[model samples]
Target chain A: MQALTNRVKVLDQKPLTFKERLYLPAIFSGMLITFSHLFKKKATINYPEQKRPFSPVFRGLHILNRDEEGRERCTACGLCAVSCPAEAITMESAERQKGEEGLYREEKYAAKYEINMLRCIFCGLCEEACPKDAIYLTETFAPANYSRKSFIYGKPDLLIPDPTKEPEAFAKAQGGIKAHKEKVR
Target chain B: MTNHLNLLPYLSIDFALLFEKLLLIIVVVTGSLVVAMYTTYAERRIAGFLQDRRGPNRAGPFGILQPLADGLKLFMKEDIIPTSSSKWLFIMGPGLAMLTAVMTGAVIPWGSALKIGEKVVSLQIADINIGILFIFGVVSMGVYGIMIGGWASNNKFSLLAAIRGASQIISYELAMGLSLIALLMLTGSLSMKTIVEQQMQGGWGGFLGWNIIYQPLGFLLFLICAFAECNRTPFDLPEAENELNFGYHQEYSSMKLGFYLFAEYINMFISSTVMATLFFGGYDIPFVNEANLANHWGPNIVALLGTVCLLIKSFLFLFVFIWVRWTIPRFRYDQLMDLGWKKMIPLALANMVITGAIVLWLNK
Candidate 1:
């Protein structure tokens, strides 16, 4: 006998008029609406040829960062491996040998770093947990690969280009995320 | 029979004429197949555009090669036949559909006769006097494809859909026939060539010539019935995908299934051409004197242009068919029946009576 939220409405069950029964006018109007849509901008981005820009904080694939001096920043601390919800990261630490200072930023460095991209959730937690700013989630996502072994990204796959040796690639790898942040600020 | 056979040799066989007609048949069949192929592509593209999305564009430039790829895929698929099904009838169903679909094109006058060297070749395959009746007969037979296919499948959904398709076609045929009666009265002939020629007769200036101007209600009824006959959206209850689980061809696989699907597109193409021929002046170029053009550029060129014009008209109709498909939702089966039997039949009957009276008054 009492309505709950005053949202209930009576159904319009009245019989249709002669004009409504004809259906042509309504059909024509609906057709006109659809026809107009032919000129409207399409929502799809033609995935291969064009791509939508990711947000500044958009976390995608992991990239092992290199400092401006082209030295690896990771000190083999294993914080990223601990913070990774997916447990996708693994590494083997080796004490920096003599004459290896140019290669590594710290006394202790990762000898073998791998990220199973199939397991990585792109949550950016690993990036947040890294103390030395060794790892970051790049704007680029993981690409498709045929083999499961190919998805197990090794140091060669995850490492950013040496800035001093390949400045163009290094800048390109860092360009989107940094520029997006700057623009937002 | 022997005497007739002997006279046939004296008739000289008209080998050149026979060859030309045979060539024309091949051209017409292949051309229709190509159009139907492109129509599937267009339907997807138009549907995409209407929904504000990009459709298939990966195969080739703007996906022009998509249909070829689709045909290849269909060809490569594994053919399966249910063990319970009637072997011959199940096989014959899609074949029969393909036959009936292509047969309708035989009587449609594609263009004026072309003059070649020492012979005049008509673009039409067969300018049968009872062209409209022939179309009706073939279209009616099209139902057997669905009926036999559905029944042979031994599936309840398929059987139900087949019954629905048969009833829908049968009900709509009444209204369709009644509406065409008025047009036939106006044209004074059932021959498509004669109707088109009549439409083209009274100069190039007035809109009064096209049957749509005179039998507006009849044209509307015919158009609606045509949509019903084509089993397109708004009347696609027989293949209500969600409800009927793929309908009459549920058991079909591989190219057999492709044939059933291809038959629908062929039906749409033929219906569009028929509508153009009956109501819109088939190959008559509007606002241009074709005779003058023929005199200036030769009959062959003019005939080609007329063919192009007819194609353009049919394409516009096809576009509208696709447009309407994407715009409207399917009708309830009961509503479909009600519309076909009660509303359309009465309206078409009334239109026929009024047109007959007017024709009589004009004659008096």
Candidate 2:
């Protein structure tokens, strides 16, 4: 048969030589190779003590964004809930009261928001659908927990720390994603 | 000359002799067990290094406490007994394996005799006339453990693996025995102590008397057979995890399984010591006149140093064992049998015949 491609080559089907049949020299050479590997640097990272750097575009847990003044960025427009492929997001909208201007960034605010972590595919579709930069995917993943019910994350769980009250925590939480965004810009 | 000096004490048994023997036995058994434990750790570490990875560096520094942690885990595990299995025979298997492995150490000479004041203390637990034969008897018995365990399990895989192990050991034993016969002819005595003493005397630079120089072919044959007998990789078809799934110990659980694994390491340790004693000059410190050293630094000190030398030699053998395990892949069943019967047997026979002719010619 003709060759399908130039890369195809015929294999040598010759019998083993006397030295090859002996096996000791081959075994010795193989042992030498493995012995040489003893000095080679190991590939292990000693995990828990050290961790590898995640990629710049790595998306993990959901974080509800807030403005610099610490007021909620979400207007309860339900765009993120509609866009979520996993159907994990849910919210209840409420009309902001007269005295609640400090808490709400818009007249309409989310009274309750929940994301079922088990159901969330972490595809970052919800982050893309948000018009007000209200939601973002942080570089920190969800931790292991016992009960199934605990996986249903409430607004308190997803919300970023208020910048005015906990500036260090908010900055630390936003550090990786913000740096990555600045690099892209 | 040295054998005569050592033999006189065996004629009569006193309280001191009995006490000395008991102490020696305790020390040897405990020492072998501890060495076997560390061997598991070394095997893993060496295997990891060969693969360009770190293995078991937790629990303690460099995983020094890994064996202890493993032992504790095995003990803590549930002891499961298969309902269909023979309870009595199933229990006896690992115990028999461990017993035979430890029993072979009785004849190996740890060091030259230590002289403390007017009394002389022999380092060996037993100086039997048929020392090599006793070792052979014990090593052959080791297969029974595998056989019984496999048979008792009533599992098809276990039984098949057992048969493979038994046949492999039996086939290799022939080559091993034939190889040793050539060395026995040269040494002219079956006693382990006598063999070492012979090697220590009348050779160039004090180290040329080792059996490896005279019968390199015999040593090679014996070493290959030892790997087979120990059921290490390349010959570990019986415990072929991919094919047999724990093999003979498939039904075994907890400490019983631990016993089987521990027995293998002990077997490796004992075989290494045997190889060192048989070919590498057991307790005979290379390139040094031990008698002259004893005069300068006391007999006890020299004896201790000699023991240390034997240990060093055995450890080197153990390292080679681990190294080979990592380097070679397991042989196919047919290939294994072909190597044993067609290759090893014929080579060993040729080696023995050549050795015999040389001995006869030299004597004439």
Candidate 3:
């Protein structure tokens, strides 16, 4: 039984001395250590009142992107659904009708878009696979919900706020994306 | 002289004394309950700080209302009784535990007597002559609560934990009693009021008169045994969750479980008060002669201040208890038994002998 490597060192299995056996000194030292931690900075971020800043590249919940004109950017390409490792994404495409130019960005639009949030691994593969820049992972994590049915996010749940209608919400949702774009530039 | 059956004079009620004692009892009981509630909050907060984390702060500012919230939640929980358990004993366990816990407060002298217009009122609920012995007797009876609860639970783990709790308390009580005997030898009294009075009589501005000066060895032994008696960590084997689940209260639910938990905190509070009374000069304001203060200020103010001083000392002891709990891990069963039987008993015996010799020699 030779040493496997030079790094392998034997543990000291010697009997404890009288002082060590008393344990008072060790206990005192431990107490001092814990007492010192009383002044140390706490590692908690008070939820609701305080939040830790996420890195620019941090991936969280998925969000469907909208163009400057508040029209959907997705052209029903099905690239995100194909590339999704979790197969969380699903959609049904429909031809854009006349007088619906304000709603859809292209001739064909996603009529029914869904993401099974329970199945989502949150790896951002769908965002990576999209060629249209139609999907992005925002800095908002999924909130708790009671039913399994509630986790199946539909188009309305995934879609970002219309910039023209809710400027504040749209800006807040776009904060991480703006920072990410600046970092990339 | 009128008749042999004329016991009316002896049986005459002192209305003021009765009123004062009744008021004091109400105050002490409610005060200890409030202190116990806060102690739970403080324990959690201290544990958090020790581990470099912030404890509960959501219920109210700094989570001050956490104990109330916890109590409400426990009350709201469904009360579950095991079908196989003994109905009466299972119910009686927590009640007995709580009864013994609150009963220990009766003899503790909170402050010097307060002087009203024509009457003097003692702050103690009952200044029993054998105060220390009374505490010991009641504390020993506390074992029955655990024993009955564990046995009645009809679970093997609960029964084993109950036995451990009983034996632990018994073994530790010997050393605890022995250590207190050394203190008793110096004071020559069992009355807690007399012990504090003796401590307040000497030089060095009343601070040197504390019993801790004479019996450091005894104090150390007593403190260790106090922790054991309270079933605190390093001696908390009876409630070893990893091994015994919830111990004697395993089958308990709702307020029954709350009672057991509340009893533990109450035990900590009372032990802290006892340690203060026995060794740290209970209700004796250090560095100031209380008599002079009572003369200068009103007796009521002085009495209130003395009570405050005693509370401050006991709170420090409670902090030390929580601090030690967070610092040390639980002891092995064999190690616990070994410490109690071999180490504490011998050390306490030696302390008692040494203290007795010193006391006799000083008188000579």
Candidate 4:
């Protein structure tokens, strides 16, 4: 019975030496090893008080973006709805009225946009499919809610804050995503 | 006969002594419960630290209030007794377990006597003549609790677990007793106070005065047996969660379950205390003349210091108990039995004989 490889050694069945049989020395060494860990840095973070930093390109919840002039950029093209792997996005388009130039960037605008957060996998396919740079994945994820109805994020829930009126919230929602794109360019 | 009859009133139980003993009992019982409660918290905290994680820290500062929260939860839980089980025996199981666990503290000498006015009060609850034997008896009775609990549960797994627990205790008790016989031979007394006082004499090197210096093998054997007696890890096959589905207390719920768990921690505390008393010189402070301290300060202060020293020793033992639990994996059932019957028994016997021979030679 030749061995298949030199590395494959037979099991050692020899009787234990007095020291090995005693088991104290080995047990003490093991105890000392565990004792050393007492002084080492703990790996756990106190979760609520401290948070791990997210990467710049980290895709989380979907947000409907607005142009620099605070006009809605989405034209309800349905490309995002088609590309969304989870089929979470749905919207209704309405023609821009004669006096609504300041409200909408284009003639066709989304009157009602809804994303079912429960079905969303946050794969960022919708963001990639959008030609108007309207739908983007934000750094913040969806928070826990009581009901399924609450999880269905509507236009109000998904829209970025009007940048002109609330610059702080708009910048916070933007996070490092804009800076990440600028660095790449 | 008339003179003896006249002295009966004076001999009738001293009111002061009765009062002191009652106070001591209350202190001991309450202290044991508090320490046992904290031990559960400490176990989790220590386990967490070893594994590089934070344990329960939400209850209070450093999770000091965790045990209280746990106790409240257990209390609030609905008490359930199985329909098929023997209700009386099921109820008595945990009660007996707790009783036997706390009863071992009676003979342990916590410290020296305190001098108050003209009356000297011993710190121990009862300095019984056969203190070690009393501990053995109580510890053995602990098995009955588990046996009854398991048998009354009407579950086969619980019954099997109960049998394992009983047999393990019985098998290990032999080697444990054998190892202690050597220490008994050296001390020439079964009384715990006498053994402690003997160690306090500090012959030759002061630091080497403890019985552990004389009977290292005996101490090691006794320690292993103590682990078995407590049904801690490595000898915890009786409560092997995976195989036995929580073992003897499988059907127990609410405070009955809590009682079983509480009894385990109390048992660990008592075992640690006994190990400290027998091998580590109970309340004897090492490398310093306690008598000199008593002379300089007061007997009360010295007694307090002794009590603190004993507590420190017991805590160290408890830490080691927890440490070993987290470090070592449980042994296989056959391996556990083999270790108990074959390896431990022979080593214990040899240690006893060698100690006896050495004691004889030293006397010669």
What does candidate 3's lDDT look like per residue over B1-364, in tens digits? Answer: 7775697778889887788788988899999989998999999999999899898888898999999999999999999889999999999999999889888999999998877777888889888899999999999999999999899999999999999999999999999999899999999999999999999987765799999998898998899999999899879988999999888889999999988888899999999999999999899888998878878987899899999999999999999999999999999999999999999999889988988898899999
Best by lDDT: 2
**Model 3: how far residue A62 lies from native, Å:** 1.7
Q: How many backbone clashes does every candidate have?
A: 0, 0, 0, 0
Q: After superposition, how far is residue B291 of candidate 1 from its true place, in Å?
A: 3.3
True contacts kept of 2: 0.78
Candidate 4 wrong stretches, greater than 4 Å: A1-19, A179-185, B1-11, B204-206
Give the TM-score of each candidate: 0.91, 0.94, 0.95, 0.93
TM-score of model 2 (CA atoms): 0.94
Q: How do the residues A1-185 of candidate 1 rate in per-residue lDDT, one tens digit apiece?
A: 78787898968999999899878999999999999999999999888778888766677787888888899999989999998899999999999999999999999999999999999898888877889878877677788888999999999998989988899998887675466436545
Interface RMSD, one decimal, each candidate: 0.5, 0.6, 0.7, 0.8
Best by TM-score: 3
Worst 10 residues of 4 chain B by lDDT: B200-209
Q: Between the candidate structures 1 and 2, which one is better when assessed by lDDT?
A: 2
Instruction: Flag regions of model 2 displaced more than 4 Å.
Output: A183-185, B1-13, B202-205
Error of 1 at A111 (Å): 3.8
The DockQ scores of all candidates, in the order shown, are: 0.80, 0.84, 0.84, 0.67
The best-first sequence of candidates by TM-score reads 3, 2, 4, 1
Cα lDDT computed for each candidate against the true fold? 0.90, 0.92, 0.91, 0.90
For all candidates in order, state the fraction of native interface contacts they contain. Answer: 0.86, 0.78, 0.78, 0.61
For model 3, the stretches where C-alpha displacement exceeds 4 angstroms are A1-9, B1-12
